[model samples]
Target: MLKVQEIRELIKLIDESHIDEFSYETNGTKVSMKKNGGQIITETPTETKPATPQKPQPVQEEELKPQEEVVEKKDQETAAEQSSNYDQEITSPMVGTFYQSPSPDQGAYVQVGDQVKQDSVVCIVEAMKLFNEIEAEVSGEVVEILVKDGELVEYGQPMFRVKTV
Candidate 1:
């Protein structure tokens, strides 16, 4: 559970800093905060109140059997697919509008299945009126292009998946 002091500190940081978003994860708790157009949005785990003492009612066990079976099957399926191939995720270095090419008429810097060097320009991210070229940090073949051209992207958001050479 989050303490009152911690929540106060988070609010203070958001109010004082220029950062638009913040996320924190600890143990099983996750908190995500976003500031959009002067509005602050916070997402945290829901807290459940303790049930008060009341007259006990008879419970039906038969109705829960089918739900339990479905949940078990889903868990097995998830476990079976747990060993799927892992690809290197290319995340945005900054918050900006993502562009696939230098100019509208120009071809994209990279596409799926294209080979890229460590310094290769993968795409461009326009931030605060400045167009910054983004590079592939690792030498690899592009396995996926996760963002569309001219789409707005947040800082640290995954923009591509590159299978390292």
Candidate 2:
């Protein structure tokens, strides 16, 4: 259960952050909040008791390690396979609305077949009213633009694929 002060702090943090919705559940208590325009709407906390007492599951550290290693190995292999298809990818550094140009009237920073050097501004990501310039970290030619202008992008989401020189 969260205290009133803790809940208020959570609300304030969420309001300041890029998160549009938040939900937390613990010990049968659930709290949900959503943002509408600039207002934060918080749902009344709900508390429910379990119909039956449940036994806690026992865990072995030894059992967890192998599974974790296997999952990590698989993820690495999948990432390698994807990266092999493109020399490099320009990915969003934060969750925000992706904009290809500085403004509606301006030309896009980069497009397919465009050559870019490291530190070249490739796009902008607007979060919490701040427009952050996204850079191409690798020197390359833009082979594909993965995201459309004005689209909502998630952290680490690929925005462009570049063929490194």
Which lDDT tens digits does candidate 2 get at residues 58-125? 23545787999999999999878767657988887667899999999999999889999987999989
Error of 2 at 117 (Å): 0.6
Off by over 4 Å in 2: 1-85
Error of 2 at 69 (Å): 21
TM for every model, in the order presented, reads 0.53, 0.51
Task: Give a tens-digit lDDT track for model 1, residues 1-165.
Answer: 654336446756874789888998887777677767353332121113223452131123356778889999998896456324325777786678999999999999999999998778899899779787787878888877889999999867889888786
Candidate 1 wrongly placed segments (more than 4 Å): 1-86
Clashes of 2: 0
**Candidate 2 C-alpha error for residue 142, in Å:** 0.4
Window of ten residues with lowest summed lDDT in model 2: 42-51
Best TM-score among the predictions, by candidate number: 1
Q: Worst 10-residue stretch by lDDT in candidate 1?
A: 42-51
